[model samples]
Target chain A: MDQGNPLVEETASAVSSLSEEVVRVEGLWKVYGRESKRITSDKYSQMSKDDIRKKTGNIVGLKDVSFSISKGEFFIIMGLSGSGKSTLIRNLIRLIRPTTGRITINGVNITKLSENDLLEFRKKTFGMVFQNYGLLPHLTVLDNAAYGLKVRGLPKGKQYAKAMRFLETVGLSGWEDYYPNELSGGMQQRVGLARALANDPEILLMDEPFSGLDPLIRRQMQDEFIEIQDKLNKTIIFVTHDLSEALKLGDRIAILHDGEIAQIGTPEEIVTVPADSYVQEFVQDASPAKVVTAGSIMVEPEVLLYSWEGPRTALSILKNARRSGAFVVDKKGILLGVTNINRLERIIENPVESQTKRIDASAITKIPSVSEDTILEDLFGIVSANPYPIPVIGENRRLVGVVRTDDIFETISPNRGDQND
Target chain B: MIDFPEIIRIPLRDWIDEIMSWLLNNLETFFDAVGWSILQVMLGFEFVFTHIPWFIFIPLAFLGGWRMLKSLSSGITFALMLFLIGTFGYWEMAMQTLSLVSASVLFSLLIGIPTGILMAQNNRAESIIKPVLDGMQTMPSFVYLIPALMFFGLGRVPSVIATIIYAAPPVIRLTNVGIRTVNPEAVEAAKAFGAKRKQVLWDVQMPLAKPSIMVGVNQTTMMALAMVVIGSMIGAKGLGMEVLLSINRIEVGRGFEAGISIVFLAIIIDRLTFSLSERTSQNNQSHE
Candidate 1:
């Protein structure tokens, strides 16, 4: 509505940016049982969650939780069952009211919305997919998907067409007339996804959507969910107790402990640089290689040579750096190849008049390298087979850094001087 | 042995009678409106039942039973049972009894379903109505006749009222239980989707609670049928009156014939309703 006003338009465009903060929660606390309001005051606010529970027979569901999520980001809230992950997520969507604190979404404080306004805002802005694939048993698949649109007062024809499009997007085009009970769990979850998407809400709230699924189906569903998220790019606030799921899907992960946020960061950051002992213990059993990336472990290449540099020059650089290999890149930093002292020595010793090459022909293109975005786990075999350090290539085949086998070994046993250089 | 307590009387009946009199006096027009509506429904059912020839009604009943139960044997048994009642020379009286039962069940369902829905929605209403439903179920059926007579006087209307009071509780209680017992997750899903209160009740609650409500309707219909014989005591002419006349004359054969006819009618109605409820409910559709 304010598209014409330059200042208003700028702010709107800023909010629409993928990296702009969309959802912000400040000092949110939800305490259950008698006189929950007391928890907001000085007397109770200073007490620990357990102490408050013991002193006043109250259950702390959330405690002083504050975080802000960017637009189009897959933000995962991870915790154990009683850690208030669900309570926090529900509070975000206003499904469960917080005892005290403010939740501002797109700059509007949702905590202050009246009941009617909250419902209206929820209908317009948020679509939730539940853990149990909450499809109405009486409605057909199409009707289930169309339910949100119907509630929002879309015309009957538009609701059907939109629901059909969403169903097709979720790969459920033919099962439109079938009731939810007739569908498999995975299929029902697709319907749930479709239902949420059909409403065209700005944000998606998913509460353990794949938890009820078996391992095989859950994996498949996660792939499908990632694919859907890529296509739709909706701002998602996903809640899960499974650390693996959080690590797999989250662009940014928030770890909750005892109704309070332990840490919030990217998956790599959470795994490699956990904020506290709670988060460290939480991610201890999770496979680090799944989230550990080449870029995170890569170091500045000790020896690099211009492609124009002859074998003798490359040899000196590798020898000085105490390395077997040196990467040869063009002047623009695009990778050409790697040359080692052994290959240079062989070329120097076997220099025939007809074979006047600067470097050994075999070493010119045989070097194994990986992109900066490649996960370390994916290069396990590649890195182990090669004696030379794996060159970490960045955009346009530019040699950015190198990952040594020693670095890989150190990353594996993280407790030994566990500082990321 | 307890004659010493005669001085300390509990005047519960007096209190009830006073309340009843006050209700009758204060709400005369309301009662009259209700009585007129029920009488109209009764006459409508009576007209159709009495005017239909035995051949048409019998075949229709057989067809309904066959289709609803999906069994030929049950259908034949139902047809034969109706035929046996017909051969007893009480077809007219059976028709009258059928009309009365139908009217009573109609009103019971109409009143009970909304009351049940209300009780299911409101905890306070549930707590208040629960004991009242229990009393309605457990009280002597004859006791309802006193209030019915006092309110509407003796005739078909009073008998209908008495039968309704006796028959209505099962449907109300079952409806309440049914709606309440619907899966909370499904209700939560509806709420999460932004369904308004009325939309949630109609679209989610009612459909899921339907199987239980059907069971309630079946029970109510059977209870209404049970009230027919007692309803005859209030001067409503039917198969019950025939049984009463046979008892007065001490004719065992006549009484047996009339009694067997009543049994035949009961079996027919019960089987029909039970099978109908089973057919309509999607409960059988969901195996697990």
Candidate 2:
């Protein structure tokens, strides 16, 4: 299985060691046309995009932006149209040259390379999938997929073999001879992806690759893309305007607004704690239930008791917590079930000398538990059926935390900061 | 009567005439060399085309049509049409005219395609060549003969040169438009894959522009055939000269026979080339 494939196992941990930065951009700025340098100068640095353009007749593509992408991370640059997300991605690959910046990919400062050197660098270091599919119309699917390798001066036999393998990986094995125009939009983009994958570059740069697809196909493609990324575990920098897509696919997402980075964080953090009003409003329409996992909202249960504890002790613990029910777990914290005050009262009525004998096994109610990774919405039905808190379990079914009904309600409701935005 | 004033007499005609005469006088050797080389190629085509007997040539034409258009019926019909030209006793003249048209089309394609590709690549070159192409296409066909006559003298070479000038513009114009109009995304994709400029032009642009270029070839061939009679006015011999002689002697039967033969040849060439272009374009689309 491509999932946990051994080819890239080392890359998963190679990123966090900051010295191993795969891609880094510092003080990047791109202004279109002749006045780029003038517009990015100190005097016009603080101006808005429109103001700078009006003053210097130069459209700012990216403002003084700086970020570093770790190796093997699915980093997303997300923004609305004209917000310069596309420009930033293109600049990283040197497709659109930045007016002022230093871009270091795999520790080589690509921004300083000559034209011939840059072209050669791009051939070896980057593979790009475009929104338009960018498949050559005259070439068949296999030939189109093999194009990158062909231009790199690979032998024809090996090119075709690698192309066929990638095509199979992309699930287009049977349609190798079909041309771009004959295939539907989704299939064409798959060919585009396969073409990039055949190059096997260090990073895959995708710019709105699914935006041109139909909604259903786009959704399916996104899921397939995530699956492929899981298997390949390549460093990917995906640019999209869709917030949901960014949240779903990105290990970390950077939000760009008016040529500047608004915020960058994990999907959960971006949704729950936006950096500013602009980011708050940007995430207002995103469904929090989908973005917020059970782990994010789960709290440590205050009224957990060991099964070895007697009924008298359980009653006292519940009384202190002001809860009618208390969750019982074994030594390793595996959830036994919920034991309430009523069950403890019955055990107390028996009044056996041995506390273990007095405990009523039949009184314990076995309620459904949820895993830490379950989304908030999936817990809604399970929570409404029982009054007890849902135990959040981890590996080996050990209790980690509890998702109370109140947590579900509070997480779904819009944040107080969102209202101010 | 409202008459324009002639206060600004530029003497443009006299200047052009004097320049033309000076070029004719000074570049006689260079013109002779070019004309000699061109004449050799023309005679080569005429020898190959005219030497083959009618029975053998008809079958060869049938095979060409069949292979190109992929239709046996069209091939047979094309063969029958050639037989009709032979029955009119103008087969040799028809072959002569075919050779002339073939040479014009070949040379026009050889020179025009590269020039068109250059124009497509460079904006400055396109700007310079566009007006020249317009002049070449719109100027009267007869006007080209004067330059040809001065350059090469009245003969087969001069007639062929005149025919080339009249017929070559469509190929050049269409080739430029064909390459220029290729989808920019395809070119960008090629470049993104690390293809050099020359590689992109050959591997991507040319294949995509092929249908348009073929259409240009068809139009150029038609125009060349159209210039045959005009070419006969400058000492070229063919069905066109037969028509001219019959008209001068007032032999209506002879003129009619020759004219019909020319029509038959035109239909054969047009149908064959047009179908060839159609077949290739369909092949491209079907794969898609």
Candidate 3:
């Protein structure tokens, strides 16, 4: 908390440094009730599911949910189906209005906009991507890609150029004329992305964008999303139920439960120090050691270190560092050992440790320099890729810690059944 | 010879008796009553377009022409042509025919679009309407003539009534097809945008459906043109009457010329309406 929470930092970075806000929603609400007043009132939302059954009132699609999304942030909202993530995304663009909340976009309360003004605002700001890709079936890739611009009264020639450029950005350069139905799901999603990008909007709202695709495609899309983000640095709010996805893409994620913000934090916070049982259960299978950085687990600069001989072998290094078990290293290349037998077994038994071992400059295999700040999720991935746990190394390639499989397993498998991702 | 037939001579008495009873009781009385009722209805909706001073109609005609066809030359040319028809001594009849056709098509559309929208709203209505539209479409154009005669008379009104029957099917079919074909996702997207029930229909549904509905309108107008010629036999005028007059007099050259004129009219009207639909589609796509 002293260093500033990662979630808060991410949100701050997402908002303008020049200004504290990008988009603010003050008590956003959407209800399927006959009147607008019902959406704003807590009385209706507080009714128990049993009470609702007895009273037989309308369903509350989203309650007075209020959260601001900052600029350049990869904000994620995680929930089960029907948790109103979709409604929340829609409200950002005023595709739906919050019954009671004031949505300020760059200081403009979009809820007060007239129809024409609202259309202009939507046309000018915010790009949207849906799970199904929603490419027009009749249009070719180029046409579909250009639709946002075309719809905004841009001339065809200009629209086509913009569309083609974005199409190439999304890796669909050669697929300009291909129809939606002809393309693969990933290809179609690429087109969807291209279309959204064609307008060059500042904020992106992706509603389970890759959920409808196959698993392989989904993973590829997630990687593609990260790559794109790395290049564009645009603000993004990605909605998903897959916690793994939330971990992979989110800078900070907020879990929604029954139309409320259950918790908001970085992947490490969610996995390690979950706010509640609900948050804890959601991160049950993940190891905090892998998720949290060395900075998080390092015990103040005080630990015993064993200096080993040159060209130290993996078994010897393992014996020396973490002799008590795994020695986590500091940023200054100093060894900080929290190593012990129980930790060693845990690190060695990790599902990783097959293909991710480090190799020497020569063809020979080498050890990995695992720092205390390294996240367990990252460590688990590296460990899974090797048969032996990658030897954690330090400055001049000296051994630091020997991460094991059980370390990861211990991080997770603590207890389940309290959180919804 | 005796067994096969004594020529059925004994049935002559019964035949005479049956004929006399039918004439006295049902056939003669029913025919007269139905004939008179048909004539009266025609006189009811009638308006005197002939006495309206032709110059006043020109601007009104041009306004309609601009709105419907959106062409200056089209509007001006239409006015000139109507004027020419009058100068050529065929104005009164042409105006009558135009009015009848316009009235019938209007009434048909009024009934069709709302009905189609109703049908589009409910699956059961759509199911019921589909077969009815099919039946109406498949029925011979001549079949509409008898019903028109029964309901109205063999004049402008009955002819217009018949044209409605002939021209009505397309609007119903197309309206249903258009509403059905509207993108559900767009509707959903609109809903997500916070578009209310009415906004969804007007902004998303109707605008998207316009192209298909226009095609239906084109089909209806064309059918109306075709039926106008058939309606002329019952006293509706325009080129149809000219064609009939030429045919009656055995003036081969006149009939041929009149027939060619009808073809030209068909081409012109069809192109204009369809082109309007196409332009609208273009406009819709432009905004998208």
At residue B96, candidate 3 shows an lDDT of 58
Better of 1 and 2 by DockQ: 1
How big is the RMSD of model 1?
5.1
Query: How much TM-score does chain B earn in each model?
Result: 0.93, 0.95, 0.70
Of 2 and 3, the candidate ranking higher by TM-score: 2
lDDT of each: 0.84, 0.85, 0.68
Tens-place lDDT digits, model 2, residues A311-393: 78888888888989878887788887889987787777765633464234665788888776677878888888888788887
- The clash count for each model shown is 0, 0, 51
- Candidate 3 lDDT score relative to the true structure: 0.68
TM-score: the better of candidates 1 and 3: 1
What level of docking quality does candidate 3 show? incorrect
Q: DockQ (Cα-based) per candidate?
A: 0.47, 0.40, 0.06
The C-alpha TM-scores of every prediction are 0.91, 0.88, 0.59
**Top DockQ prediction, candidate number:** 1
Judge candidate 3 at residue B60 and give its lDDT: 67
Q: Model 2 residue B6 lDDT?
A: 73
Looking at candidate 2, what is the lDDT of residue A262? 93
Question: Which stretches in model 2 have alpha-carbon errors above 4 Å?
Answer: A1-14, A17-19, A53-56, A257-262, A273-282, A329-337, A342-374, A378-387, A393-400, A414-421, B1-11, B14-22, B63-67, B70-73, B243-257, B283-288
